[model samples]
Target chain A: MNVIVEAGANYVGVIGAGEGATGEQMVQARRVGELLARKGVRVVTGGLGGVMRAACEGAVGAGGVTLGLLPGSDRADGNQFLTVSVPTGLGEMRNALVVRSSEAIIAVGGSWGTLSEIALAVRTGVPVIALGGWPLPGVEVLVAQSPEEAVEAAVRTLAR
Target chain B: MNVIVEAGANYVGVIGAGEGATGEQMVQARRVGELLARKGVRVVTGGLGGVMRAACEGAVGAGGVTLGLLPGSDRADGNQFLTVSVPTGLGEMRNALVVRSSEAIIAVGGSWGTLSEIALAVRTGVPVIALGGWPLPGVEVLVAQSPEEAVEAAVRTLAR
Candidate 1:
């Protein structure tokens, strides 16, 4: 079967923890999504819970499109915030999808899962801006203190 | 797109590094694949190069079914060793698929990527057998010295 892949330059990855996200971190992720959406960016996320849910909520709340790349085979499993859900059945490997499909990555508080996406983004030369995410040595991950800064950096990176 | 998802018990995850696998490690992976296949277990992997390729080769060589859950959107990106390639388009997140789909996990020498799968498997109550793989602090990962031992232990774990 042919699965229609999401293709475009307007997509941006908001990488973060799939679970156990702090309430503050979720708020920041949501704001980041809102800011990105205001710029006409289509937010891409892991499509599970915590930060993913919050980000998608904020983006959709701001009347912007969002895509959820679910790890399971059922689209119904995606968060209520997503405008489109693609049940990839790819599991955590979908982290690579979030990185590869986005023009740039705006990272929030994350763990092992978010770190994987950051690594993949760096490997593929996709610009990554960490708002409050794990920092790796020897990799150039731009740091932003707030959601607005993160979106601005992503926009500037894409412009270049 | 009615994408066919590979589900159920015959599936087994062979976890390892995406690259930088030692020649000996690859051999062990291949042998483990062969043994599992002979026992009618369908081998599952990330579907990239190195150990993944070797394992798929050994499984298919023994006339056993093998599935490659690829990180990209193109099936052509999979190694030639697999019997079927499902382009998961999920990147490293695909590790979750391997953990959730398999009845048991046979972990070879791996890096951070395989470590994630191990964590997932342990949490999901899927049995795991480690062959020179990283050990977790609190998880019960059975150790094996050889590919044969690893496969045997994995099968036993599933049986129980």
Candidate 2:
């Protein structure tokens, strides 16, 4: 089966904790999504809950396009805020799709899953802007103090 | 798009270094694939060179079905030994797919990519049987001294 890669549109992944994300992380992720959408960048996410749901909500609320790469085979498993959802059935492996579909990544919070994505992105030369995540010593992860800063870093890196 | 998860095919992932794998690791990986295929189990891999290619070669030589989930968008990126190849276009992030698609994993050797798969499997409750991989102090990875032992451990775990 052939999977088409969307052309011309800038895609950015917003990755973070799924179920147990803190309230502050959700808020930050939502803001990051909103800002990215306003910039005409497509917001790509894991498409389940917590930060993923919040990011889609914020982007959709702003009348922007959001793509959810779901872990299950059912599209209904995605959050309500997604503009388009694809059930990848890759489970946590879908995390790679999320990272690959984007030119840059803005990590909202820390989780084992998130760490895996970050590691993958770094390994594959995708720039990452961590808003609030665990420190990786000897790894070059761009740190962002706020959502705005994260968005700015991501966009700037994409520009380069 | 709906991805059909092949039913009734017992899949086990053979993961390790891609381009820079050692000769010994390639030999071990091939033996593991041959053994698994002889047991009527399907072998899954990342569909590139090094350990992945050797494993596929052994499986196909043994007349076993081998599936390669490629990192690129083109099926040509897969090795010749693959009976079927799916171009996932997920890049290094496709490591998650490799882990998620398998009932158990037999790591022929270790790399950052291999480590990511192992981490994903451990987090998601998939069993792992490591052959000459790194030490994970807290993770529950079964150790195998040879490819025969590794395949035995993998099939035994799947049985349970």
Candidate 3:
């Protein structure tokens, strides 16, 4: 019998909405997660609702492993799609942790909290791929018109 | 002339999608920004696309200052709503920077990327608020069913 060694999966950070799901943002976030799953990449996000949930659902649906980085201390805070939920006691400061844990960041539609996460991501030198918003200051701007293009750009960037 | 001290706003880090707006995710993200703006909080995020853009828009719309953290070296990566743009060439590593810069984290939903962020957040002991995802270990769990509730939880947690 030959023993095979399994390598650790590459992690990607996702940030976005957590309200009632219903609109273009939700669709795009889900599609992006699916595309990333199709590419055989593990997905990471702030397990909540809206875009985060959509992405988790998409990734899990695609037979991919989805990790949920929680904000609270309980597992109930996480969505059902998450394979593993890591609880971070950090409250508002968790933004830094999110940025630090990922090799790259794929930003979707977001708000104030999301903006702060993006800032930290840029400061840490993570490659951020944007789909329909403004580009980062000194990083490569992978602006995609569609979810497919956004994920494609992220994959291509990761490949490099 | 009486000099009134203007309270320095908390440097909030934002994270989210980057596609065109209109969805549950987008709405949630926007609400986060709105809440922050109403409180005169400084918002930060990846200055592009879906959630980031929406958050920035919401913050600016509410008379709040928004910052964009770009992943590339170009200003084009930043969203128009950002009052300031910080350019970072770190690529995906920028995610780490974002997490490091913040005092806490507010997770909207769950995604692979978000999960990674949450991991970093928890690992760093940054207080995190989960609106629709998993909670971090040993941290306060604030499962906000609405945007107002989430923001309140985040603010209250950070205050401690």
Candidate 4:
């Protein structure tokens, strides 16, 4: 229960397919992370492979803070780009941690795990912008056409 | 990372709506908890009101172990029926903890939070039995007609 409140630090989650992600999706996720990091927003992710690794790489490359909520207990399982990696050991349940830790979420692609994070964020009243994500029938999500649009929407949603 | 491996202890999560749970759902959830407890299985819940409280109450009444993963950092926020309440401080994210901690899941009813847990469990290869829950189109969940059926399914799933 150690609550560390960093003043003026905005954590935005970038959720997407972990394995089997398309190259296009990875490119979009990387750009999204870079944009958010350049804006001084901390990028948070599930802390594994595919989109999560790509986003963290982009953020770290831009000299920005990146937090990874890793699924396993081993910190070595996290990508090299993560500035701070929390080995939650909660398996895929760490997706919920990623959603809870972020002020807003930018969904880069679609997957069952990513869908669960989006569902948790929506249920908990966290604003989410999806870029090339699933077409949730009843879910209320703002669909962004590109990575830049997704980052802009996330920033604007947090401002509100 | 303190991992307490309780040998021979089977933990089953009973998830449902907290605030707007119907009386029927409460009765079913309570029966599910009681049945699981009678079999020497531990009942895990979200540690709040409605179905979570009802299930914990039943399990405690049966002199069984009941664990609650509370959403906030205050242990006092948990219901009195919980034998061990861990204040996760992860908001709705605690649903994932409940899912990860359980060997099987018996969903008494459905909500956005419950759905998130169900999705996480299914994604992580955990068995799920839905009793009076949602009919997810593409989701492969075993449906039970009553609490007894749900508890039986949970036990059988764990045995496998």
The prediction achieving the highest lDDT against the true structure is 4
* Candidate 2 lDDT tens digits, B86-105: 99886676777788789999
Listed in order, each prediction's TM-score against the native is 0.63, 0.71, 0.49, 0.81
Give RMSD to native, each candidate.
Answer: 7.4, 6.8, 14.1, 5.5
DockQ (Cα-based) for each candidate:
0.12, 0.26, 0.04, 0.42
- Give per-residue CA lDDT, model 3, range A74-160, as digits (tens): 889899989888777655455566667777888787454665576556645677776654333334445668888878767765743
Q: How would you encode candidate 3's per-residue C-alpha lDDT over B1-160 as one tens digit per residue?
A: 5222245557566665455344776788788888888887777776777777877888888888877767788988787898888888755445555667656666666443454455555545666666664443333435668778877766775542
Model 3 off-target regions past 4 Å? A1-8, A20-22, A134-140, B1-160
Q: Of the candidates numbered 1 and 2, which has the greater TM-score value? A: 2
Candidate 1 chain A — worst ten consecutive residues by lDDT sum?
A: A1-10
TM-score of chain B of each: 0.90, 0.93, 0.83, 0.94
lDDT of 1 by residue, B1-160 (tens): 5223335437788978767999888999999999988988889988988888888989989988888989799999999988888898766656667776789988889565675577567656788888986444443778899999899888876653
lDDT of 4: 0.87
Q: Estimate, for each residue in A3-109, the C-alpha lDDT of model 1 and write its tens digit.
A: 22335538898978878999999999999999888878889998888999999999988888899989899988899999898898866656667776788998898
Once superposed on the true structure, which residue ranges of model 4 sit more than 4 Å away at CA? Answer: A1-9, A38-40, A59-65, A73-75, A83-93, A135-137, B1-9, B60-65, B73-76, B87-93
Docking quality of model 2: it rates as: acceptable
lDDT of 4 by residue, B1-160 (tens): 5333457789999999999999999999889889988988999999999999999989988877899999999999999999899999877878878987899999988887887888788888889899996666465789999888888889998863
Docking quality band of candidate 4, CAPRI definitions: acceptable
